[model samples]
Structure formats: structure tokens, C-alpha cells
Target: MREDAVKEGDKAPDFELERQDGGLFRLYELLKEKNVVLYFYPKDNTPGCTKQACEFRDQYEAFARLGAEVVGISSDTLESHQKFEAVHHLPFTLLSDKGGRVRSLYGVPRKLLLLPGRVTYIIDQTGTVRYVFDSMNKPLEHVSTALEVLKTISHERNTQNV
Candidate 1:
């Protein structure tokens, strides 16, 4: 397994992936104005992935209140992502890593029988990764954890810059 594919204080690698909404999503461009939660999952409409996506959807407002945007990336196509979003009412961008290039760049390991493991990267507004949560627990919990980490990082940054 590739360890520490990304770390705190390191500039996040940029990418332009296709979004479910039929547009391009440039990582750096999106991070230009706000923090982002980039999650990589295995497939669309899977049990675990679906649960996690819905969790993010339910807490979409909370993430926004903290000036953070959640974006999910997977090896699935944009069409699959679109269907998943429409079915779940997900209020976030789902990026298509059709070639798995982004996944490889992020060093997300393949799971049993060639599946993408669950990995979440919490990046700050300046494009530095602040936290990474790699877990397959209830997807909702990951959103909460990301929010908590963002709040903590934001608070610390403000205090230091004061």
C-alpha cells in the first residue's frame, strides 16, 4: 500500500475530472475559494458507497455553513454518477475518474477483488491537505469527522494568523 499518498501541509495534487452535472471540475479552481472534501469510493450505487454519499447529502448544509464543499470521485462514468446523484438527491459534485488516473495519483489502494477502498481527503482553502479519514464505517460518520476536522483546522489557522 502506498502510505501517506497525501499529507498535512502538502499541496494537494490538482486534477480536472468530469462531473456528474456534465461539466468539468478542476480541483485547484474549486479550492481557490473554499475548503473541499474529496472522497474516493469504489462504485456507484453500492451499499457502502450509497450510504456514505447520502450521509454527505444529509449534512450538505452543515458543510456549506463551514465553507466547505464535498466532492466524490470514483472510477465510474459520469452517467453512472448522474444516476446515483439523481436517485439519492446528493447535493454535491461526483467526479468521474473513468481511467482511474486520479485514484492512482492519490494512491488509493484497490480492495478485495479489485475494488476501490474508501478514502477521504479533507483539504483546506489554500489547497493543503488538513486531514485524511480512511475508513469503511457508516458513511455519515465520515462527513461528521470531516466537518470536525475542518472546524478544528479553521480555528487553528485563525488563531495563528491573529
Candidate 2:
């Protein structure tokens, strides 16, 4: 496997992309409000990607309760994302990274250096990457791992306040 270009404690590379609704989503802008769960998947409507998206969708409320926003990114076009969102009833924002520029920027290594990689990044409000989970085969594990990391971060913050 290729080494990840970004890692925990690194400042997440900022990006702006067109969301499914055609509105631009700036990474730093979203970071100002809440922690961001940014996930990259291979394609829209594919079995693994669909399962991963729905898993994130199912756990979205839990994430929000913990002050995190879930955002998905793919090389798929905005229209494809729109249909994917609607069809899956995904509540979170899906961004279009048409050329996989954002993915490449993050150094999300492609599976076998061919297919797009599956990776999840948990970035704190300050725009630092708190955690990263990368696995092409274990799609659903991304949701569980991200939630665990967020909960840990929340707990740490709470303890620090006391």
C-alpha cells in the first residue's frame, strides 16, 4: 500500500467543490461550524459504495449529536451525486470532485493504484485531522471507526474542560 500523504494531527488540505445541489462547499468554511467526516468512495450506485453511503447516512444523527458533519466525496458528477443522494435518502452533503483532485490532494491511495480508494477522514473544527480510516474492502467499518474516534475526541474535550 502507498503511504498516505496526510495523517493524524496534520492540517487537512482545504478544498472547494460543487455539492450535489450545485452550491460550493469549502472545507474551511464547514470546519468553522463542526467537525467534518469526509469520506471518499469509488463510485455511485456500486454495491460497496452504496453500502458505505447508507451506513454513514444511518449513523449521521449520532455524528450530528456529537457536533460533526458528514460529507461524502467522489469523482462522480454533481448530477450523479444528486440521484445517488435522492435514491439512498442520504441526509448529508455529497460533493463532486470530478477529476479526483481532492482525493489526490489527500493522497487517498488508489486500490492497486487503479480503482479509487475508500477512505474516511475525521477532521476537527480547527481543520486538523483527528483520525483516518482507509480500507477498500471494509466499507461499513468506516462508519464505526469514525464514530469511535469522534466519541473519543468528545470525551477528551469534556475531560479537558473539567
Candidate 3:
């Protein structure tokens, strides 16, 4: 892991970017309401990226039930993201990071030093990163790993309230 990479328990670096719908998405604004399943992918229409987005869409309800929102970030343009969401029937926010600025903030490593790495960060409502999973070759695992971590965060929160 990169020494500068944001790790578990670190405060999530806040960022704002254009969403697919052409509206600004501010991370801290959303974190005020629910936990976030924030994923960084390389591209919009690529095979691995598509599979990862669809998996998140399929399990979206589970994430919401745990008081979380799914958000995907990539260097893809808003127009591309709009098309990608329409094609995949994605039911979450897609943020466009034109220059990989947010990706850099998270220290998301690149695959083979060429393609952007696939990574997932599970952030709680308070804006603290609870977990992070990095696996460029296992796109599907990103969704599963996020679900598991969200479940654990939910369980821990419930226990704390008791």
C-alpha cells in the first residue's frame, strides 16, 4: 500500500464533482445523511467496469437498507456517465472526475502504472473511512467486499446504540 494512501479510520477526503445528471456532487454533503459505498473505476463502458457497476446496482437496495448510498467515480465525462447509467440501469450517483483529481486524493494506485486501479472505500455517515478494498482484477469482489464492510459498520453502530 502506498504510504500516502488514505487508510481505514482516516477521515475521508471531501470532494465535489459533476454527477451524471450535470449536477455537482459534494462528498461531505452526502455524508451528512448516510454512509457511502464509494468506488473508483477505470472507465465507464469497459467490461470490468460495467460488471462492477451492475453488481453495485443489483445489491443497491441492501446498501440503502443499511443507510448507505452507492457512488461511482471515474475519469469518464458526464456525458459518458449518463450513457453508462442509462445502459446499465444503474440506480446510484455517478461522479465524473475529469482529471482523476479525486482518485489522486484517495491515492488509488494505477494498474501496471497505466490504467487507473479499481478501488472501493466504505465510509460511514460521519465521514470516516471504515474500510477500503483494492483489487483491479476482481471487480465483482469490490461490491461484495463493500457489502460485507457496510454490514459490519451497521452491526457495530447498532451495538453502540444499545
Candidate 4:
């Protein structure tokens, strides 16, 4: 693991990438509205990546209820992401990180030093990473873990207000 790898409580590295819709997406800009569940996957249309994306899609409403927005990033082309979103009916934004720069910025370690990493980062509205799940085999767990973390954060914030 890279020593500079983003960890919980660290500020998330900012990035800009093309959305599936061909529009630009800036990490800090999205952070202004709600918390972000930023996930980095390996590829588009692959079995594991598809399962992970669908899992996020299925739990998307729950994330929204918690005032969180889910975003997926991979080093795929914009056209590929568009097709993937259309085919899977993914409800959240999918960003195309063509060169994996953002992936490297997050210090997402490649699986076995070969394939791109499968990792998820739950970033709070304040731009701090609240949680990170790194796993290549258990894609579906990413959704459940992120949702749980977001719920915990929400609960903590509500309790502090009382």
C-alpha cells in the first residue's frame, strides 16, 4: 500500500472527470450538497463491476435518504460508461477516469499489481473520508458497508445536535 493512500479522517483528494452524460464532474463541487460515496472499480460491464454498480443502484435511495450521493469511477471511456449506465440502469453518476489519475490520486492499490483496484470511499460533506472498503472479491459488500457508515455518521450528527 502506498504510504500516501487516503485513509479514514483524511481529506479526500479532489478530482474532475467526465460524467457518463459527457458533462464534467468535480469532486469538491458535489461535496457542497451532500456526502459522497465514491467507489473505484476496475472496468465497465465486467461481472464484478456490474454487480457492484447494481448493488449501489439498488441501495441508492437509502443513500439519498441519508443525504448522500453515490458516484462510481473507473478508467473507462465516456462512451463505455454511457453504455454501461444505460444497460444496467444505474441511477447514480458514473465518471470516466480515462488515465486512472484519480485512481492513483486516491492511492487505490491494484489487485495483485495487475488489475485496477476495487475500493470504496465514503466521504462526508466536509470533504473528509469517513470510511474506506478495499476488496477485490467482495463487490456487493461495498454497498452495505457504505450505507452502514453513512447511517452511523448521520446518527452521530443528529445526536450531537441534541
Candidate 5:
């Protein structure tokens, strides 16, 4: 399959998706407020997705302190997200993209017929995609890698303003 993922410096296509918590999230709105870590996973409650979610949850406070918000998207329904979050104590937003529309906008590939491919996007404060990770074998590294990019950008912006 062709990798249609957005590249760094490209304006990320904003989307409106249903949250597992019964709310609507506009990607641009969140980007306007803070940098975003938009991650896409195969399925809710699955092994890899769960590991990715928990790692984000564990470091959620640091992400917030860095003025970034982490959000996960999957084709799963709101009910599934709710159950997964409750069972794992996830501390951030879980978006339910049942239609896979948002997933397609992000160009998340379909590696498995049964699961959405593992991918993550780090959006800068200006709403541009700063980084994209498409590998599923090393899920935990996704968080750290995204954080490093965000921190570098945040530092550079601060330095320029000073």
C-alpha cells in the first residue's frame, strides 16, 4: 500500500471526531490551544494499543506540563473506548472514529484486515505535522520520540521569542 502519511511542515488536516466520553473533538481547536500527539492504533483493548495507551497515560502529566495534549484514535466505537479506558485508567482523550474517516485523513495504513495499522502524528503548536511514526513493533518508542520532537520545537520557539 502507498504510504500517504503527512510529512513534517505539512499542515495537518483537521478533523472532528467523536470522543469516547460523548463529546466532539475538533483537531484544529486542540492545536490552537496546545501541541497535539495524535496517535492511531489498531483496536481498543488489544495488546499493542493497550501498551501504547498505558505508556501515554503514565507520562501524561509530563505531556501536559510540556503544553501538549495526547489523543488516541481508533475505529472502535465509543462504548469500546469507554470500557478500555476504564479498565486501564487512561488519563487522556480517546476518540472513536467508527467511520475511519479521520484515520484515512491521516493516511494511517491498513496493515491487517482486522486491525488499523499503528501510526502516530505529532502536531506542532501551529497545527503542522511535526513527526509521523508508522511502526508498530516498537510502540513505546512512539511516545518518547514524539515528546523529544515536541520538546525541541518548544525550546526553539521559546529561544526565538526571547
Candidate 6:
């Protein structure tokens, strides 16, 4: 990660992109409602990407129950994301990063100086980035790790109000 990269405890940088459905999605807007599991993948339809997405899909309901939303992003086109989402029956939002601007904002590093890196950020409803996991090889870990963090956040919030 770069020195200016969004880090844990920092307020997540707000941005908008064209979603799979062609609607504008702003991070700050989403932060108003639920904690976000904002993940950045390399591309669409690739084997690893597919499995990572499906892992999120399989755990979609659990994320919702924990008051978190799962969102995937990449430099792929809206059309490509639409196809990938339908083919995999992905139940979450997929955003098209036209020129990798958002990825750059988050300082998502590239793998082997070629491929875009796989990274996941857990941002709470208050817009603070609670956690970040950047692993090029562990796609499935993104889902499980994010869920664990969200569960902890939920527990903390409940205890805070008690």
C-alpha cells in the first residue's frame, strides 16, 4: 500500500461509479445505511474472480444480517460486469471502474507488476475503514475475513448501546 492509501481508521474516500445496472453508486451514500464490504478484484469472469464472487454470493445473506453490504469493483466495463453478475447469479453490486481511478484512490497495488491486486476493505456505517485485507492468492479469505470483522463490529456496537 502507498503512503496516501486509505488505511484502517481513516474515513473511506467517497466516490461514485457506473454500477452493473448503470446506476450511480456513491460510497458515502452507502455508508449512511450499512457497513460496506468493498472489495476490489482484478477482472471479471476469471476463475479466481468467479470463485471469490461466489464466495461472497454464498454468504450474502449473512452479510446483510450483520448490516453490511458486499460490493465488488474492477476496471472491467459495465457490460462485462453485467454478464459476470448474471452468469454467476451474483446478488451484490458490481461497479465498473472505467479507468481504474477508484482503484488508484484506494491504492490497490498490482500483482507481479501486471495484474491488479485483490483487496478488500471493511468500512463501517460511520464511514471509517475498519479493516483491510490485501492478498493476491487468498480470494476466499476475503469473504470469511470480512465477515469476521463485521461480526465483531456488530458485537461492539450492541455492547456500546448496552
Best by lDDT: 6
Worst 10 residues of 3 by lDDT: 1-10
* TM-score-superior candidate, 2 or 4: 4
Q: Write the per-residue lDDT of candidate 3 for residues 41-63, one digit (tens) a residue.
A: 99999999999999999999999
Q: Model 6, 24-91: lDDT tens per residue?
A: 99999989899999999998989899999999999999999999999999999999999999999999
Q: How well does each candidate superpose onto the true structure, as a TM-score?
A: 0.92, 0.97, 0.98, 0.97, 0.95, 0.98
Q: Would you give me the overall lDDT of model 4?
A: 0.93
Looking at model 4, residue 125 earns an lDDT score of 87
lDDT of 2 by residue, 117-137 (tens): 998999999899999898999
Model 1: C-alpha RMSD to truth? 1.6
Predicted candidate 4 versus true structure: per-residue lDDT over 1-162, tens digit per residue? 568899999999998888888788999999999999999999999999999999999988999999999999998998999899999999999998878899989999988788999999999989999999999999999999999999999999999999
Q: What lDDT score is found at residue 148 in candidate 3? A: 92
How big is the RMSD of model 4?
Answer: 0.8
Model 4 ranges off by over 4 Å: none
What are the clash counts of all predictions, listed in order?
A: 0, 0, 0, 0, 0, 0
TM-score of 1: 0.92
**True-vs-predicted CA distance for residue 116, candidate 2, Å:** 0.4
> Model 2 clash pairs?
none
Give per-model CA RMSD: 1.6, 1.0, 0.8, 0.8, 1.3, 0.7
**Whose lDDT is higher: candidate 1's or candidate 5's?**
5
